[model samples]
Target chain A: MKDVILGIDIGGTNTKFGFLDRDGISLVQGELSTNEGETVHDFLRVLYQEVMTKFKKIEDEANLIGVGVGAPNGNYYTGTIENAPNLKWHGSVPLVDLLKQYFKMPVFLTNDANAAAIGEMVYGGAKNMNNFVVITLGTGLGSGIVVNGQLVYGHDGNAGEIGHTLVNVNGRGRMCGCGRKGCLETYVSATGIKRTVYKLLADSTDYSELRSVSFNDLTAEMITQAAKRGDKIAIDAFEYTGKVLGMKLADTVAHLSPEAIFLFGGLVRAEEFLFDPVRYHMEKNLLHIFKGKVKILPSGLGLNNTAVMGAAALAWNEMERGATA
Target chain B: MKDVILGIDIGGTNTKFGFLDRDGISLVQGELSTNEGETVHDFLRVLYQEVMTKFKKIEDEANLIGVGVGAPNGNYYTGTIENAPNLKWHGSVPLVDLLKQYFKMPVFLTNDANAAAIGEMVYGGAKNMNNFVVITLGTGLGSGIVVNGQLVYGHDGNAGEIGHTLVNVNGRGRMCGCGRKGCLETYVSATGIKRTVYKLLADSTDYSELRSVSFNDLTAEMITQAAKRGDKIAIDAFEYTGKVLGMKLADTVAHLSPEAIFLFGGLVRAEEFLFDPVRYHMEKNLLHIFKGKVKILPSGLGLNNTAVMGAAALAWNEMERGATA
Candidate 1:
């Protein structure tokens, strides 16, 4: 029988699952509503049922060897999901423990960004790198730092929180869900660009297509589309976001000295509109020694497959290290 | 004969050497002028002669096993010191190769801060910690980041340069010897406090004993003494320095999630004058998840012998890892 690992990515809106072989080739994949069940246990039960139904289709040819999961606030060390804001689960939920009841295979989990980093190392552009950072830019920013070929879980399970570091310290700046002001995420994420567009509309008299979009209705895709059409406010928003991200990344380089920083998630789709300014400002702000040494690249697993592949990569990595169920 | 490792710390002003047992006990320690020779080879020759003479006194009880040297801009991966601004060497100098000519044993070389970090792990307060940061506050700030009980050497072996990260982004700030402005060290080191005192003296009309001292004559020790005596300007300088250092450290904690941060060197002698504000501000700025979790502690290796112990620890550590000359 062909050996396979199960990869699961639990997001706020949907939960995606896939079965893949050692080379990261998916045999089957599908998604379900994350809130289909009333409780955490109910959700996991449904997920397990859905996964088993999918696995049975290939049961004769493929063998299910292990399971891996990626989710917000997932703790690699504790095997729990700790109060992830986007999910309905409000307290520490023993995710691994619940999953173990369904699958008698080695199970591992980590925060989505860390899983993405592992995926990058095992299957993407960072295959040869021992030290690098992965930045996930979605609704909010998330990061995964790798050093000496191992993910840095830090002293606690929650080490990669680069999003929350301050960008402005002098005055009360942008408010963040974490209740902090002037955070890097407040200026660099998809929501960050939307916020920046509004601020630009307020400050500049220049005609912009974004001027008509309601604050709640505006999206990063709309802004990118507008910038492509020569919208001044949208273009300025991307520039400002890049400036903030580049400067903070320069600081990150000083701290971790990663070989490269990989940018993933939605905002990266802006392509050169985003990459150009980020590369420019990151180089401009980098210390002389770090100049031209660090590369900024896109996620290599392809955007559609990142979450699943990340989870799969985590499972494979843990199993190789001799971790048991 | 008892085995001992030779530890050498080459500073701008002096080169200190010590022979230490595995238990971190010093067999003998001494210092010599760093620039007594006209060239790099001459300096190494004189250093070798001085170390040999010192070893003769303890030769009956000690057997030399290996050597470890720490200097500014030292590279562990390359075993070279790369154009350190404070050192007279203008280009890459093969420090390990030069030291090998004398001992014929295993030789290791790394930056002073990295050596100190290894010392902290092997002998100091962080003996039990797997992730921690060490900040050396002297003429300029230097840092060593320990993740998973190993120093982060980055891609080019210059990972821990937190001192060069920016604390300011607007206007022309204090100039750094590294040709950058507004670096963290420019505001938080020994010379940083002096610059702060001068700025404070110029900004306010408060009565102060520091008003009589010139910039060149002023020192961090003098500032500590003045603050102890209730001199307002001196006290305010320490407060400002603490505020900046604490804020930056909060960001560091966010990135690394280190269990504790150890402050070392001359500036730490300010005691509560520095620690109080740093703790308060760091606590005030830390993310809720990290709040009250990370500790700010003094270096457990003490002040006078830290360099020697650090280098000794590096040598022993490398020997255990099977690195040889």
Candidate 2:
């Protein structure tokens, strides 16, 4: 029988599971509610039940090789979801161990952000790059740093917290969801654009459409649409957000010296509205050796399939390196 | 014959070469003026001639296995010293090829700071660690970032420039030797402390022993002596220096999540004056997950012999990696 691996992305809202051969082509796909209960057992049970139906039909056609999982706070070392704040699960959950009992196959797990980085490396533009960064710009900024072609999971499994790194170290700036002040995410994420827009409305006297909107009413999509129509406040918000992101990324460039930085998420859909200012400011602030040297590119993975692809790529990588390694 | 490897540390004023066993015991050592002429050819000739005398005597007892040279702006990938400003050589110098023509042994090269890092990994506190950073607090702050038990050379072999990373992004800050403003080194190195003192002298009315001195007349040693004697300005300078260094290092901890950050240089001789504030500010600024977890410790290597040990360790590492690797 032909061999295939299962990729599962356990997100806050939904869990997406898909089966793909070692070649990355999907053989089957589906999703289940991740918040169905506090534990992941319910979701995995339903996912497996659905997959088993397909597996029995394909028994003579394909073989299940292993399973790969991606989740917030997922630890590659422990294969546990360690108190991921977004998930219904409150504390460290042994989701991988639970999956293994159901799937009865070799299991591998890593943080969702790191899985995305591996996806970029395996099936994206970074296939040839050994050093690069993958940044997810969703509600908050999530980052995965790759060095020498391996994800940098530091002393703790929580090595890729670039969002929380300080940007404005001066007086009390924006407060972050992480309970920190002046975090990079406080100024650069989807929520960050709203924060910037709020600040811009308060600080500037320019006539703008954003001034009419309340904090709860303002959305990143609305701001992008406004900027596309040449709204000064909306455009300024992206520029300011890009300025902060580019400057902080310049610092990251100094620290890790990655060959490129990959942008993934809805913010990337803004195209030049976000990319232009980020490139401008990152280059403008970088050291001479790094100035104009690093590339900022969109992720090669499709936006909808990114998380699942990341998990699949992780399995493919483990297969190549031997699961134990 | 007893096996030996030659370790060379080329400084702006002095070039030191020493022969050592795989175990790192120095067998023969000597130094010569590096600026014998405008070119490295003359310097290498004098260096080789002095070393030949020792080699001939040890010919019956030792066999030379390899050579490792550490120089400013040294590129490990190319084995070339690219535009090292401190050296008499004006542009890129193929020192490895030149050394090979003379010594006839496999040669390895990296920046002086990276060499120090390898030294720490081989003979110092980071022997077993796969991730750590070695920061050299010298004429200018130099850093070598070790991730996954190897130095991060980036794409251009210039990855560790933590010194040059922006610490002060405010209005036109202190100008750095590299022509950048507000570089961490401008405020944290031997010269950096002096710069801080100069600023403190200009900005503050607080009286101290430092007021009696001019910029050229002052030295880092004097500041340490004053701080040791409980002089307020000197003590404040070290505190401020450590505060800045520690805060920036917190950002680094966020990036690489190194297990321990090893401090090396003359400033470290101040002991608690520097280390105390660095630890304090680093912890104060670190994210909660990383807070109180990362260790900031003094390097285990001797100050005078660190460069030598580092180069020796590089050769030993190369030998173990099968030279060709």
Candidate 3:
């Protein structure tokens, strides 16, 4: 039988799983609701069954060799997800141990952002790069830093929490779910721009379509559409968001000195609306030696099953490392 | 023959060179003036001759295996010193190639901070650590970031320039030697604190011994002595310095998430004056998950030939990697 690995992305709303061959073919794929209020055990049990049912069709052609997982707070060292806010489960979830018992295969796990970073290295723009960063912009901002071709897991399993880092040390009253003020996520994420929209409406008399929308009704998509239509408020919001992100990226450059930074997820769909500002401000803020040297590029994975691809890459990397060792 | 590495530290004023056996002994040592006004050729010729003379005694006991160099703006990828303002040399100098002709052995070079980082990992507190940062608090704040047991060289071999990162986005006129305003070095270095003393004197009327001293005459030592004598301005200077350093370190933690940070050079000698504030503020500013996790420690090597030890470690690490590969 051909060797294949199982890739799982444990998202809050839905869980996606697929079997990826060594050549990167998705032999089989399946999905199941996470069931927000249900026990993690119940969810995993259902997910396992669903995934296996799909895997059965290709059983004769492919052998599932190992499992790779990506979750909100997945820890590679402990193989647990701890305090992931969006997930249904409270406290730490030992999903890896539970899955290993059912699958009887080698298992590995890491945070969602780190999974994306490994994905970039294994199957994306950073294939030959030894140092780069992957910044994923979604409901919240997430970052994965790779130095010398190795993921920076830090002393703790939780190393890449750039989203929660403060942009305004003495910020005026903006708080995050992480209970911090002036977090980068508060200023740069999808949720952040909505908040910026409300703040702009309150402070300015400028007429804009966003002023008609309620805070709860407003979505990142609406803002993108408005910006595309040349609404002044929407345009300004994107510019401000990119400014904060570029400044933080400049800090990342100073600290890690990566060859490039990859921008992924929803906001990247804005294309030049976001990329132009990020490049201009980042280069403006970069140290003289690093000026015009680092590239800020689009994520090659796009929006299609990045989490699943990331998980698969993680598994492939670990399996390859094990064999080489 | 017993294998040993030669370590060299090229400073603007003085250059230190020493040989180390595999057992970590400083077998032989020598020094020479860099003589900035003269051509690099003349300086290297005299320096190589002086180093060779010192190596003569140990030549019988230990075989010269390799050479490691630490200098301002030293690039490991190209093994050159490029555009270091502190040195009288105005442009890039191919120091490694010039030295290689004299020694005819493998040579490696990296910036002073990176050398210090390797020294910490190979010979100091971080020997067991795979991720840590070394900040040398001397003439200007210099940093070396180590992730996954490897030094980050970035795209251009200039990854860890943390000193140049801006502390104040809209900071009031604090220009650095690097020609940037609000640079962390402008507020955290020895020269920075001296400048702070002058600023404090200009802003406050509190009578202190510093008012009696000229800018050229005033020193960090005198300030420390004054603080010991209950001088308010001197005490405030240390506090303000630590606050800036700690706040910046909090940002460092958010970005890299290293196990610990090692502080080296002159200002670290102040000990509690710097440590207490750094610890207090670093923990306060850190994200909830990393609040008490990261440690700020004094450099284990201190002033006892750390530069030599660091350069030696770089050479030894390279030699070992070459052997294993």
Task: Choose the strongest candidate by DockQ.
Answer: 1
In the predicted model 1, the residue pairs found to clash are none
Q: Provide the TM-score for each candidate, comma-separated.
A: 0.98, 0.97, 0.97
Runs in model 3 with CA error above 4 Å? A171-173, A323-325, B170-173, B323-325
Give the alpha carbon lDDT tens digit for every residue of A1-325 in model 3. 8998899998878989889876567888988887833798777778878987998899999988888999998988788888888887889888778888788878889988999999999888899998999998888999998887788888887788888777777544479877768888988888998888788778888889988889999998899899899998888888888888888788889887889999988888878888888898888777889888899999877678889889988989888888321
Backbone clashes (count) for model 3: 0
- DockQ of candidate model 2: 0.77
Cα error, residue B123 of model 1, in Å, equals 1.2
Residue pairs in collision within model 2: B2-B61
Q: Residue B258 of candidate 3: its Cα lDDT?
A: 90
lDDT of each model, Cα atoms only?
A: 0.90, 0.86, 0.86
lDDT of 1 by residue, A225-254 (tens): 988898888888999999889888988999
| Candidate 1 residue lDDT tens string, B1-325 | 8999999999988999999999899999889999988889999999999999999999999999999888999999999999998889789999898888787999999999999999998889998999999999999888999998888899889898899888876425799887878999999999999999999989999999999999999999999999999999999999999999999998899899999999999988999999998998888888899999999999999988899899999999888877664
Candidate numbers, best lDDT first, in rank order: 1, 2, 3
- Error in Å for residue A320 of model 1: 1.5
The C-alpha interface RMSD of every prediction is 0.8, 1.0, 1.1
